[model samples]
Target: MSYAIGSVSSQDLWTRLKEQFSTVSRTSIFQMKSNLQTIKKRSDNVSQYLQKIKEARDYLSAAMVHFADEDIVILALIGLPPEYNTFQCMIRGRENVISLKEFRSQLLAEERIVETHVPNPLLSAMVADHSSATKGSTSPFQNNSSPSSFFSGGNRQFNHTKQKGRGKFNQGVKFNRQS
Candidate 1:
């Protein structure tokens, strides 16, 4: 009876060690497979996000280009030619793009039109929930604070009576006034 019990115990230990060895040997391979799956899923998600971002940027840039042009954009916002017609900004070059910091000063120089308007009821409720997820913001338009500032100048003084066309001297851009 004692010999039978010893034999059974020895078999159990050997069986346990064999199972443990198998588990240990396979661990790194299984872990690598899991990690690869996770990495593939994350890569797919990032690709999707980047594609969406590119589309949005293309559309936004088209709109900004129309606005940046001397004639079409400023007129749409401020209203009428030959009055503010002479008041064009030289957005053609790359060098003079205004800083976001200076944007505050520029808008402040205008009226406080950059201040967020209360969104319509449907829009307002959406803003309320998502607003907490971000920093202190409540409007869709209030976050980036770009060309909105340019629209703030309410009562513009049209001192010059130039031609109702592109550039004060668009052809002779060199002579056109810059301040």
Candidate 2:
């Protein structure tokens, strides 16, 4: 390291250092801005995602480069996953820009709604199986057995016989007509 031989005032030395190292600050600011743009929510929860964004903003602030709250809000929305598309549209469509606090609150609420509404894979499979099984049945109550057999406790002794007909009521019935 080189040392100054003459006594240098602290202010003079600070000025000299900053003038020499100004490029470092510019590079730091550029990198931080790039990082902010590329951030993504991916697997992180709402809070974690917001925290990551706020940290990047904080770094920019430390480097004397500050973004407006609206800009920050836009950045946050841009980094959201596709599942939040509706929420992003809502925010973008607002007449007034939302504060960061309100944005955070709404985002968390939306996250809860999304979590609650997500279909369970197992439940979905069960429903799909049930619908496929019942596809051709005329009535929801119709199962493997004939209606009489189904209602009569599966007794095979019943005289009911299957017949081609317009409806269930006439399927196994006999009617006499008098002229």
Candidate 3:
């Protein structure tokens, strides 16, 4: 008896494939296909980018909160290049800040500031003074341009530093003026 092996037709092959698919449960195949489709899904949600932007915006807002009206006046006075030693001055018991708009006007009155600029020392003095607890008004310097005034003797911010006292009282110095 001779067996016809290669004589199996294309129809027989299709039947074998159909029988295999039928043996496998349709519900399990559908669940696996759905799972694969879900895993392969791509979306345009920029979650990471949005999170980064939120973090940057939060940092910017925090920086803004640190800036106040006093900071504007301070920057106007001292400029941003040099360091403001307000914290250090407070440690030395000096309590002052270039916070008064009136004070800026007073310097402008003496033509010390070029009608436009206040130096950094004034801001440094103001920052240092702000850190200290004061008991009395720090305004003796406002009385007159005396040799012993804290901010007097004209606008020291614009004065020539005569070598007579190079570092004694050329610029904004602190003094506990007693009445």
- TM-score of each prediction: 0.15, 0.55, 0.18
Clashing residue pairs in candidate 2, if any?
none
* lDDT values, one for every candidate: 0.38, 0.79, 0.40
For model 1, give the 10-residue run with minimal summed lDDT: 75-84
lDDT of 1 by residue, 112-137 (tens): 33234344798776676556534554
In candidate 2, what are the lDDT values of residues 30-147, reduced to their tens digit? Answer: 8889999889988999999999999888767655688999998998899988879999999999999899999999999999988788778999987876677578775435656666
- What is candidate 3's lDDT per residue for 1-179, written digit by digit as tens? 02223438767665655554455455655554343223210221223322333333333333332234344343333321222234224322525555435534543343322324556897877767644513365443445545444444344544445556456453446567799
Q: Rank the candidates by lDDT, best first.
A: 2, 3, 1
Candidate 1: regions farther than 4 A off: 1-105, 109-111, 128-179
Residue 154, model 3: lDDT of 45
- Candidate 3 residue spans exceeding 4 A from truth: 1-7, 41-179
Candidate 1 global CA lDDT score: 0.38
lDDT of 3 at 67: 36
Q: Report the error of model 1 at residue 106, Å.
A: 2.0
The TM-score-based order of candidates, best leading, equals 2, 3, 1
